[model samples]
Target: MEQLARLEDLPTRYVADLTQKNLVPLWPSLRNVLPPLKPIPHTQAISWKFKDIKPLLIEAGELTPIEKAERRVLVLANPGHGLENMRATSVIYLGMQLLLPKEWAPAHRHTPNAVRLIVEGEKAYTTVEGEKCPMSHGDLILTPSGLWHEHGHDGDEPVIWLDVLDLPLVYYMEASYVEGGECQPVTNTGTKSRYGKGLVPTQHHIRAKNNYPMLRYPWAEAKQLLNDLAEAQSQGPIQVAYVNPETGEDCQKIIGYSAVMVRANETIQMSPCSAAQVFHVIEGQLELQIGTDTFNLEKADTACAPCFAQVDLINKSSEPCFIFIADEAPIQKKLDLYSVRERN
Candidate 1:
């Protein structure tokens, strides 16, 4: 009876304080800001099929002009999250950008970090700040924040690639900025082709521009690197993380990027990770198991796994399978909130 009476009188005590400065007690709002249970992510395992996306890309290529539309992209919006903003998952945004032959995507720069994984049709090049980075199937291109970049295709067929960006973080920080300009003239003249290799300037230039030095990581180089590493190991998938040539840091400050190649009929088990990840299959077929759900993926297909989700990769084909993977571990690590647990 005493406790009930005190609890009932609490509102009366709060009334005077509320009236003075309009201050409310923190106890009622504690559950929202400091809940006992961690948040349950609404994101679920989802995959995007290439068969359904290709035709739409073709239609868009025919109906839209690259210069006029700026970017002909189809966003892969997750049904479970971000209905209004149309995010791929909770923190990442995935889109398929298309460019027809002889078309050029105007030069532009933005604050959000953008990564591209080539899907189909090549002979296209993404030029960043006067350096041209060629694009091909299975290649991964990194365009760091505030870097002027442009895309153009000179091939006979249309070019398409997956555009992955950290828009959620940009929105959260309210640091979004975009501007367009004419393509910059190429100046670097070395043996690196200005498209496949990074040009080394002075240390002053390096520190002045803190963007990722390696603008383009060709598929041929990655495949050869994986093959060479696989020959030495002879077991398990050969994986490598993309790093900036200057500081040897990750390609993106907030995103950790890696590519893996699984030999035929091989299965690799991954431990539970604290960072949410999404994988895009570049070649062969993949059976991706996240927790209890298993998703079958093929070339150009993308699969997602939330944070703390255990994953398994199985190559269900006769040849090797390649996958481009991205995670938020970089951001989580910055907050000292990253952890991983091995799963049996």
Candidate 2:
């Protein structure tokens, strides 16, 4: 008891000394303010199975209305992070949202940039600032930060999509802002009428005066490009990043995206990067390796790799494996902290 008492008085003695010297020491706060190394990674390798989540999504659609639910979504929460808040990784947020037939997700806008990767359903689309951008399986739709956007489905089946955002990073920076948008729905024109079957017109005009000029990146054109690239090459995975059609830059300022296809029985080279990445399996099966851990992921399953973690992928299936990825490279690059090294 005497020794414990003496130890407890150390802080009081330090404070007295600090007051006399007009100096505030940080030794007492060192444990939290400065650790020997990174205390813990903000992300971990985790996967969510569509088979497990589909029923719950259907139940949510049946039980809740669009306006009441606000947005019917199941966030992909990382097990290594807090459960109270849903985050796919430390810097990124992901959610699987559902839009049933005739349902309209009301218009809204936020400061954190976002993208939607269509997972399932058909004849549904998201309208961003007066342009109706249709959604299909494997298509990517962009909603830049502070842009007004809303979702609606006129198809016979439910529309499901994986929503990716840098909300966690925005929240960390204390720059998060959100507001209700003008409650209006834009006419659906399916892009072809405006762009001529996925081809950008010579004199195309943008409605929203935002950073990114294009709102929709059609899967038809992107898939054909990937196919053409694969036909010309025979070795490694065919990968392409989604970019702004106008500037050829990243779709969002803080979020990055890529689509990769690995041939059957092939393995991807290991890469160590400074930006965390969340990957969703769009087709086939593959093994994801984060450091010493390995996970088998199938279609509609999501996986994460923390920043600076050595990672690689392997496709042991007979069919090609298609994966969609969201990266925090834009944020890192903006801060001049982005780097990648090949692991030998």
Candidate 3:
């Protein structure tokens, strides 16, 4: 392939005049904006070990009070995008948040959609729009865009959760902002009890449904479903998508969440997709091969892969391994840019 002309190839006076007029040549940078075969993604495959982050998170809880910090969190920033950016992928933001016992994080609503994957401890609950969703190991709680939510811990130990948000995308669009509010009166409990066995509340047929009908996805239910799927199928990866029970669509508009279970001594090659993906280990251990890099992820650990990267997950443990996945598929599909390359 022939190389595109460089900016230096142009005459100095012409370049100077173009710059003075606040205009620039496109030919010199055309290839960068329109790469030949695939995008040159800035997101690289990287892993964050919980063992290394847990201590720091605990120390943060001791150093900062809930009133001062609001939400004490340590961001899991990907180096490829520059650590200062605090981004896990092009669109995903990953952070490990800590809530010490008897602490409360004030109610606030933000424009960027976010979810919490409970990583450790219990007796903590997130109140979202008047619904109190309890935090449990491996459980997923949604704090969608513009929803008033706050955190409270009742247990003796510290509560920590991995916060996955579409902040970078919202911030890039200049639409990200937060509004603080007083504590909300708990008007409702988690709605997961009303959804099961492919069934939803009968009221949906007669009345209008809430945009986010279910706020909490318990890990116990998801794990049992994964187990049933593994037992029912002899081959292929066992995975279940976390969707909105009312609309039967992706839970959020920007990011899609799923749970994948890898059987003992098994290996699964994920199809290459156009959207970048994040993998958080829920149970057991697994070895992840993202493109050319390999990472051994333990419980509560997290890893991310760039768009269109070849990913392979291997479970060398004696027990089944479960992982929580977050990706840019929902927004990509909305924009008509979602694609999966066929394996050659």
Best by lDDT: 3
Q: Put down candidate 1 lDDT per residue, 1-62, tens digits, no spaces.
A: 11123324576757677869977666555555554534456567788899889999899888
Go through the candidates in order and give each one's C-alpha lDDT.
0.80, 0.81, 0.93
lDDT by residue for model 2 over 83-128, one digit each (tens)?
6668887789998999999988889999988889998999998888
Error of 3 at 239 (Å): 0.4
- What TM-score do all the candidates reach, one by one? 0.85, 0.86, 0.97
TM-score for predicted model 1 compared with the true structure: 0.85
Residue-level lDDT of model 3, residues 18-90, one tens digit each, is 9999999999999998999889999989999999999999999889888899999999999999999999998
Error of 3 at 126 (Å): 0.2
Tell me the lDDT of candidate 2: 0.81
TM-score of 3: 0.97
1 or 2: which has the higher TM-score?
A: 2
Worst 10 residues of 3 by lDDT: 198-207
Ranking by TM-score: 3, 2, 1
Error of 2 at 187 (Å): 6.4
What number of backbone clashes does candidate 1 have, counting pairs of residues 3 or more apart or in separate chains? 0
> What shift in Å separates residue 108 of candidate 2 from its native position after superposition?
1.3
Better of 1 and 3 by TM-score: 3
